[model samples]
Target: MGVEWVKKSFLVILMMLLAFTMSACGNTSKAVQKTEDGKVIVDFWYALGGNLGEAVTQMVDEFNASQDKVHVNAVYQGSYEESLTQLRQLAGTSNAPAVVQVFEVGTKYMIESGYIEPMQTFIDKDKFDLSQLEENILSYYKVDGKLYSMPFNTSNAIMVYNKDMFKQAGLDPENPPRTFSEVSAAAKKIRSHFGTNVHGFSVVTHGWFTEQMIANQGGLYVDNNNGRSGEPTATSINGEEGQRWFKWLHEMKQDGTLGDYGRAWDDHRAAFLGETVAMYLDSTASLAGTVTNAEFEVGTAFLPTADGMDPQGVIVGGASIWMMTDIPKETQNAAWEFIKFTAKPEVQAKWAANTGYFPITKAAYDQDVLKDRYNEYPQFLTAVQQLQNTSVTPATQGALIGVFPEAREKVVNAVESIHGGADPIEAINKAAEEINAELENYKRVNQK
Candidate 1:
């Protein structure tokens, strides 16, 4: 009986050992992998969707094919907010991606997050020529005289209008409105000519538009030079510049010429395409798609400024590529190599043509691919010219607030409130107070 019990126990122990070995083998197979040729693997998390996402995947394929030293695994992580949320959870972990794409407004948060390796480190180490890139785009990513990330997919707001509607309204199709008053006048004329069938002008209930309007008038969004010189203690959106923007919206709303499409970009674009709205503000990144999709002849122009204010320029509104610190050193270097490839003029030209984003490298303009694209879509020149014509002041450099996403939400609420007949001054003031409180809370939590 004792011998029989010993044999059974031995069999059980052998079975447990076999199961453990198989589990260990499965985990090893699931671990991060390298190419058969020993190329370093890089995991890249991106937020763009639809065509933009496809373009990113294409670029990654090209980059992998161009080099044998590195292989990048591109993964779609959903919307910018969703992807950032995922990163927040996975950051500082072995599962974290070697590279991540973060939106422009997340700059301050990223700088304070301690999860990234500033692009400046790689730039300095490799002596990369930042002068080769667009200064206006770079200005937005630079903090305290250091570039934190590499600019990719950069865009600015522009006014897109239907030339057919403009001519019908007795307005010059060649020359679009350049100021708030001009836009209002044009909008009223279009509405009057179309007679209840169409509205004059519409802007998406987005905070980015408000930021652009204020910046165009050389107005700061926050104190301390838009928070670049120092941490901002308060928002300046309640100032004269901001008031002018709000008042313009209020007047437009009162006139019934400003279409209320809510905040969905698709809704606003649909209104324009459906000819329910004559003109609207949209990102330059949408230029190609808008022109291709519009049934009428489309015209592109610079964003309107407040009357009597010279255009300070629109801030670049897009995402940049950030390197993660939790990645292995070899992987980081591989990621940097991929980043440098993305910045190449040829690559930038292809990306710009495919995505309608401004090529970060100025030399991309000299590339035949980009030149051909510009020639084919002449409307694309307006955005590039607008960006080139902008003065790199603190206002145009854009605001840097740790709570910028929250602040933008407040501004959006204020715009909606004003559109809903709330007093513009009161709404603006309330939004400002809310943003200031958020900034204070952020500083308190992040104080070091």
Candidate 2:
């Protein structure tokens, strides 16, 4: 969920490759492992940290313990970008991990370079029911209509509110804001009710909010072939809608209703968890860890939309399990078994229940365990509904620049300009221009 934990990390790694490189859900990580002796060791590199990292390690440990045929060694790669560079460098050599968690945006590059193996082959060979996975999730990693990766922990944007602040503001805690006006109004109400003790809404003045606003308004994030990764060129998103969204945030930040970025991603979460902010826009996967530790009762709602526009469109955000090429078939098959095992409905339900990420398979949703979860945790259902209603529109397919993550950093820079009172349209345009330059360089250097 969010920007894709491993994805953004590995993207930085790739960014570090040139400049250098650069670069989820759930309460639980379910491991339905089988033990088969005298097999092989499969290396997995992940970029997640803290609880998410621990959960991943736990899953890997269980997977390893489950079978004698495979020993999956889990390693912590720096970030999405770092991992990507490692993957690229390891290529044509012998350092590639058997499995790497790549961001959704990197799907095309992996698919195109033929560095990663397709999941369909793994699926066919394993004989798992591919039908168990939701079509939208499956399509996320599909390029030219072929399944190239397997969806694992999936998440989407959701509104998180502080119940104490809501109650103090005389608003219904159970009914958090569902529209943009409501978001603004509620934030104002909370600010007045709590004085400077609490802020209403929090977001980094960066490309993240831009993407969220654009998606909610149904604006295309990229052009060409559904914004699939291998598109011929990068498109500019510095137009009217992007301007309006960034401008609004600029205003909010000025008015103090909006919050700023802390040191790291978790710092933002910590900001909310610390109760300095009343509402937060973040990955739905945070529910598992956040709710348990939050001082105030927590509430979650669908991401709010502007008036007159349906607030329904959502983009799939998270990393997928990618199998490597140029590896042994035994290792590939072993990796496939692990992947298939993880995708099973029973496994999916357990993982969903444990972690805040939505289960990628249908059986997980249909299971009695998940039914109980839906009844118990309404937030999970909200994410599920948004994801299921998802359309593979270009806007929702997400951007695919060669140095896409770097381009996003440029977007953050543009927003920083706005925070300093720079013109919103001009700032975005400048950012877009900078991004295009990076895009061109990537295309030229990584040209097929």
Candidate 3:
């Protein structure tokens, strides 16, 4: 062949090879297996890393080794938001994974997408006993008397404080603040005792904290019973509860009792670890890392409510496992098997002990491993007790708005505005109205 023909031929061959590789690689969560062992392949996409990822990898390896009929390929896709984005793009495609983990805020959107098989389908088809699951944890994902996904890793917000700082401030560490007013008082005391370098408390201007505060005060987040009775027509954040929360935060800031960390979750965490702040409200999911990094004795307590308002309950936070629809029966069955395995008390306990995410089921606590772990580190029990004490009210079940993530961002902006000395009532009202408009669009699109 001539030189020109030879070069063209090489280019053609290279293109073909690249195509083959791309086809074999499949989606972000799936890759072709090397072995032809007659075992079905099940791809699982998860959104955890670090120690939590290691714990999940162990579970997957154990599950794969336990069965010859199925093989699970676990893929770590960045954050929960990234995983959900990939899921939305891959749905109904041949390259889609068999299972995906989506964050709590994405729940309504996932349901509206109509791409996933309701976990209740498999549960009913297989007669899976759900009694072992924690009712409070399960309540958040259930809608219209059905669960669309499996509760894999559930958590809630709590107060994390430095007990040593408490003692130095002459405040009882065991009696951590139970309400927003108490938090303010404690913060003032700690700041006075520790001086200007150390703040009394710190909080990120995140929307989840806003949601949790409203729920704890037995207030609704959105209309239609926090979206349990029907689709939410509007959000309820501009009401009495929102005013109280933002006003308290403003007052705290004015008095140097609370540190402004803006929207960086880690900044507040670092504040806690560096002892820049004596206490802060954060996720129960943060227990393991907080305990490990803090030099002083770290303490845990239920997240504080507004003054004179006892905590009715806090909503479940964290993500859950969702199975995609229209996949092969064999692959779907295998995925369900892996999911069911993870739900087992043994696996749940292992996950809880390792990652500090609350186990989804009550039975997990009955496991000897978890019991021993809890006994060894009693801080874990605080979240467990909080979940147990939560009432099964619609508000506590969490708001299921289709535009939840957007609504949260709007709330965050409102918080920032309030921190900058804007009127709390005006900021909250503007956010609520804007979120209501978004909800209207969502309703039109979803036909709800």
Candidate 4:
């Protein structure tokens, strides 16, 4: 009986040891991986795919080859929304990536999540030079006079026009419309000359365009100075600027000038590429794709402003690189090194040339490579000039609310409602009401 009991105990101990080994093997996926050469591996999860993804991979490879202390593994985690969801899922876990590229709208939520190590933390610790950064681009990521993230790829909304269509309509292809009134006039001419199959203006009823228009007028989207001062309590989108903006869209739709592309930004791009739209508002980052896809001469300009108001600026649209907390000190330091390397003027110039995103450092514009590239394609310089012209005001600083992404969807809904013949003011007011309620609930739940 004693021998039989010993045999049973030995078998149980062996099974437990096997289970332990399997568990250890399952946890090999880590943010910072180590190589056989004992070099620290830093996993970088990014949102870009396709050509943009290829550019990022090249940058990562160059970064890896340039140094032996750290190896950055760039992982494509799908879209920005998907990447943010994955990051949230991995919070407080060992599986989180050491670094992430978060979009502009996700700024407030990322800050509230408390899972990131502010860039200021490292900048202060290492006494990094912040003076070399682009002041306008960096200002968007700042909260209370402090930068929380490192600007990576920054872009602005620009007007992409079909130059051939402009010539056909007898409008000056060299001078695109600079105001909403001028846009309407040009669209009218385009429609009149080219008939119904061609659209004068096409845009994805995206809240982004609306936001850009408001910023151009030096207006705010949410109260509390576009959420820069404190926690935003209410949305001011239904105010004068928003009303006039939506009214223009409604009138354009009524006049058969503005063609609705629903909420899909890609559809608007396709329309432009297909030569179905004369002018559209899209990100400067899409310039490369626009130039590649369109057979006609494509022209780029700053987003049109309201008739009376001078253009203040368009809000920068793009993501910035953020470091996660709970990572090893060594890993954090290594990640900072990679970020700094990427921020170098030459590196940024190459990235801008490849991805069509404006370089985030002013010095990048001074590089001969970037200069030559800009000379060849002067359309690239429109956004650069716009960014330089834009001042860092609270309204232009961009809205920072924990519920901004959701609120933007509501704004889209409002725009769609207006396109569907709903009263612009009423639709905007209703959307604002819904957004304000959501913000209140969010504050209560998050205890912010």
Considering every candidate listed, which one attains the maximal lDDT? 1
Candidate 1 lDDT tens digits, 116-204: 99999999999999999999999999998899999988999999999999998899999999999999999999999998878999999
Decoy 3 TM-score against native = 0.91
Q: What is the lDDT of residue 304 in candidate 2?
A: 79
Write model 4 residue lDDT over 212-258, tens digit each, in one string.
88888888988888888878898888888888898888889888988
> lDDT tens string, model 3, 201-292?
87788899999888888889998999888889988997798788888888887888878887988889998999989999888887888898
Off by over 4 Å in 2: 1-37, 124-128, 229-232, 368-376
- What's the lDDT for residue 283 in model 1? 94
- How many backbone overlaps does candidate 1 show? 0
My TM-score estimates for the predictions, one after another, are 0.92, 0.85, 0.91, 0.92
Predicted candidate 2 versus true structure: per-residue lDDT over 1-448, tens digit per residue: 7669889999888766764221111111212233355557777888777777887787777777776678887899887778888888875335667788987667767776667778878666657676768877776676666688888777878777888778888999888887767888888888888787678888644466667678777776556643564454654477666776767766676777876654265777888988778888788777777777887778887777776777546777778989877666767777887887778787788778877888888878778877887787665676787777776666666655556577668888887776677877788888878877776787788765
Instruction: Count backbone clashes in candidate 4.
Output: 0
- Candidate 3 residues lying further than 4 Å off, grouped into runs, are 1-35
Number of residue pairs clashing in candidate 3, backbone atoms closer than 3 angstroms, sequence gap of 3 or more or interchain: 0
Candidate 1: what lDDT?
A: 0.92
Model 1: runs farther than 4 Å from truth?
1-33
User: Higher lDDT: candidate 1 or 4?
Assistant: 1
